[model samples]
Target: MLDQALKNQLAAYLQRVTQPFELVASLDDSQTSREMQELLETIAGLSAHITLRTDGQDARRPSFALQRPGSDHQLRFAGLPLGHEFTSLVLALLWTGGHPPKVEPELIEQIQALDGDFAFEVYMSLSCHNCPDVVQALSLMAILNPKVKTTVIEGGAFKAEVEAREVMAVPMVFLNGEVFGSGRMLLEEIVAKLDTGSAAREAAKLDEKAPYDMLVVGGGPAGAAAAVYAARKGIRTGVAAERMGGQTNDTMAIENYISVLETDGPKFAAAIEAQVRHYGVDVMNLQQATALIPAESEGGLVQVKLANGATLKARSVVLSTGARWRNVNVPGEQEYKNKGVAYCPHCDGPLFKGKRVAVIGGGNSGVEAAIDLAGIVAHVTLIEFADQLKADAVLVAKLKSLPNVTIHVNAQTTEITGADGKVNGIKFKDRVSGDEHLVPLEGVFVQIGLVPNTEWLKGTVELSRFGEIVVDAKGHTNVPGVFAAGDCTTVPYKQIVIAAGEGAKAALSAFDHLIRLPAAA
Candidate 1:
């Protein structure tokens, strides 16, 4: 099941196993089961401390469990964990075999201290870019806490269960048979959810922090760059974000980044975060900024309030909170989110396999989603508000070549209609004809665009009519000591490289402003 190069790599990594472990597999006479057995045997042959057993009685065939004898540490994989989940399998092996995880010491202790029985099941797809993080996080929790158990389920392998649960998205997490969350989630975020009191404890710690010379309000490429640049100036720098990686965590392939050739969004985000941390920036994740209180005087401190009720003060602030997927405001869209409406085609496309779906928009994102879905879904109806597709010529041509894709220009999505709490169809209007039509489908993918996350800064800083932070060439907002950068600003081209460069410029401009400030009292 694995190539020679992959086997050699696995062999090298297996050397880190410090203790004995067993790969207990449940199998039947099926092609997938045979392939899974071959893969398990290949893995077992690499490490002296590993053993393979085929006596597992799990209800799911072609499934396997990794267990350490004489211990309660155990985790299961209910399908061939290849593709994005391959890394998850490797980590589970190492962690179960007594290899230490890379998490912080405090978090490890927190995981071990959790009381009560917790069972987690994460349903994910092989093509999903965000599935690995959730899978790995749950696996780590299961390995660390004796009371916690986790099972990673491949949605494609269990289509009946996915349909019964109405799981239309990837990385849909369930706790004790109830929905926990959907989409990408980090280890810290999961722990925070379970611990409950962790938020208050975290808020207390954040409230005690001293004012920083430069505080960055985000954790995307722009915020990471700003934090790194500010810290390089020998000033105290801090970053507060809802999540460390921002929207990049949900992104898939990124081939346009300069020099790096190619890399996915998660890896790029991690590299930038490591770069920021290397400069000693105090990175605070899972903190949402709710309000911005400007400084009273030129040299005074600016206070940013968080959703947790804790506030952070800084000498200068760089707002690079970035943007999020723009939702279609039509009726039933909100009522049926995750029921049939999805924003990520890569993550949710497999859930709609053999079913009809609609792609709302004709831009690059919309066209790309349609092309990707054409191979999985039965049919794709592309609706556009413009007269022509805004995608590049090559993409448009490729989309046009797809037999199952239908395009409608000058079309506006009116509503997403659903039945029995699940999406059933979509309504659209032909602008020229002034007529409305409905396309019968099981899912609707909205790829309209992005909206800046600058709602908190409203009335405090100058903003464009589109709600973007208005900044000058130097990345300075109208308010002194307040700078903005990245997609959240009035910058043209919302690319990662451009955001990083703007972040650096904003930091330098803040530093320049700092040097000319009046002496503090």
Candidate 2:
């Protein structure tokens, strides 16, 4: 049941209900079922143009089928609408009543272009704040396209379904009954798989002989910024990336990014892509870079080879290829990733707030993660394989200051333990005692150092032992016409804003190099 205040808000929202809406509820007579039924009935009772109907004893499953007059069921909400997901239910009701959803035009185009029948079965927890976005996106896609159907199922209500699908995380998306991915996914990502006209084909069409004035590699914040900066100066700029947003997209939440108050990974990444496209930058997305060839002379051309047959030559290049998180690589780790196992404390920390959690790796990043989580989470168990923590004195001091965090030295993470598709605890072995211990936790954060995406540039560019590109303050590398920036470079700190600034600098430096060249490049 909902509060009177909430009911009044829903009534106001449905003021201009156009289509006749009905609640086709199918549920057992359990207490939880009763609550859900009452909630749906209450919702239907408020509007003059709305009605309620039970699916009867012979109904296939206990779920809510939202059917509008003169139309078949367009959407389904499989469980009780509790917590933040209540907003999703409200939106669904309004949507069927002729209200437009806030979806991007390009995304709608992609949805409309879908050729085959596809069903989006989204598994989510009621308490998960991030789940609703995926549900809404899929619903809107279904509304726009006849082939795509969607069902938002609450995890707790459908225990059998959750176990069958191995749904361990909120927003676990299953496309046509198979796990597509877990976590906050964007509309573009889902549509990407369905679209036949892939980027590999798109990359093939770009002229290999013609040289770009400036070519930006990597699609993260740095590359996007570099591409935009280069394009603004009226240069023949092209951005090639496997995916847009780079390492920034791997992050969960960004509060320290200056002006912005709060933002999450998927939304932030989507915004960056949208902004880059708005500037009409020649963005070659989903194109992986395999190798880089430096210019022979000062004003000569540098070549970039893609995994595909396409080759791109440029007068100037900006290597903003970002870093990837160092995974634990233990059993069940990859399978449960984004289900319960997670990396990037800033991105996924809030989801585990007030719950017990574990942080593996005792480096600066690990200790920092422990310190950050200590304030929000109930407890933090930090495990380090080495005898002593490798973090700085200040960070170590700050970590020790937190009473809620427990430190375990010379302990190795053996396995990530979970049941019915989600992570619940961790298996660790003590080096000294040779004893294995299992600590129960709601989530696990891996805070090991990042692996820079500079391996491809080993011989062509000067690189540190960690495979990070060696660069000067102005983003100049060992090669004259080539430059590097962001996490891939030997930057002091890896921040999104810092990378973006570096990208801008790299673009400006490339432009300067282009102008100084005697020959037309």
Candidate 3:
């Protein structure tokens, strides 16, 4: 049950609603039924702009047509309001009413009067609760600017689209028909993209450039190492990573990466970046390499074209873009990311010390997080939709050894519940018979499988059936002068050290190719 204060806040938020709707009542419990009436009344009275529509009320038919409440017009909520979706509903009402959220006036002003329509489609896996922040922010922007239409498609449910769009990660944002950003973007940057047409246009212009001797496409450990080594070898090196640090950025801590004892992700990334920069490697941030094709003229160079219309020529290309963590798209998962929800336990576990927590997924990552959190949290509930843990014997053995950790296999999370802007608990359904119940907790960590970021290379590079990039012993691709390394590539063991080592190999291979190029010329 939500606290009285939260009930009041919910009431206030409900007052902002302007559209007719029905709350998709969770049929799982008596407690929910008991509290529904009081909650509904509070929400109805507090909202100045919204009036409730009972079951038999004059509800308008649902359509894609534009329905206006005012010239101050904004979206009104329709459909089931649950978890993070409810927050979106409230924000939509506020935006439609021309009332900005608690954000600064200047920021609000920046979002206003923006021309052009942008649709953001975020592909998220259920195990990745970190993705909701990206969804919520975009949904809020969509509300603030009617020109923007945002949709968050769960990765698991939309397999066709995932394959079609080559969605390999959670929290991947596709803006204006092309992949815009991944992981997360700050509020200011989002505002800038929303408000400034020129800023977006300039960003789209990163594709205009000449060729280089070596181009490392990823910014992870492997890509960084390749860049540094190539720069040292004095091969007109350039790096065109989507973002620096790759999947390592999501890691909470790295205890096993050799010589890095008790290191955090950001710290590790900084070290790699510093080393790469020391060699005078040309680093282009926030630029995505969309396509790689052989040069038209019979030269050793590969032509790399960016989504933003920038083009570059490179003698060799190293593919080190890493994999993305999978997510579960359950209700409330998107609404509470970082507000008591998390993906990487190592990065966020310490914050939950002494608090009750839940970890989803049966993979090695899930078991690892469960074992790690058991030492920190008061209690740990590990939920797996499968019948048993699929992790290694050592990890599972260690997980079983923990007294504080309780495992629930063949159970799926039905919904994430919260009040007052933080995760409070989760509801689960038994996979066999569909019996559902809620468990209260302060946090939920999702640790499912990872998807390699190699879908875009489908026709260009050879990939494993699972979509991992296939590279040879020296990191050379089937295509000459093109190489791959890291989690995105198929060398097995998606560890940081392995990626770094592979990066070094790819750089050396690229150097070898460059050295022989002039003689061939």
Candidate that scores best on TM-score? 1
Best by lDDT: 1
Better of 1 and 2 by TM-score: 1
* Runs with alpha carbons beyond 4 Å of true place in candidate 2: 1-73, 80-110, 126-137, 156-160, 195-200, 205-211, 295-301, 330-341, 344-357, 363-380, 386-406, 414-444, 519-521
Q: Write the per-residue lDDT of candidate 3 for residues 1-521, one digit (tens) a residue.
A: 35788777766665555554332222222443334434444554565554433332212111011123443222222222334344544555455445557665755666656667776766554434344456567766666667767655555444556556644345667887897876666455676665656445545555455567888898999999999999988768888776677776666568998876787665677689788988998887666777889655434678777766777778788888888877688899888876677877654565566889999988888898899889878999999989989999999999998999889999988899998777899999989888997899989998888888877777988889989888889888888778888888879888899999999998898788777665653
Give lDDT per model, in order.
Answer: 0.93, 0.81, 0.70
For candidate 3, the lDDT comes to: 0.70
What is the lDDT, from 0 to 100, of the residue 14 in candidate 1?
A: 96
Is candidate 1 or 3 superior in TM-score? 1
Error of 2 at 272 (Å): 3.4
Clash-forming residue pairs, model 2: 220-245, 220-246, 252-347, 253-347
> What TM-scores do the predictions have?
0.99, 0.76, 0.58
lDDT of 1 by residue, 411-498 (tens): 9899999989999999999999999999999999999999999898889999999899999999999888999999999999998889
By lDDT, rank the candidates, best first. Answer: 1, 2, 3
How many backbone collisions does model 2 have?
4
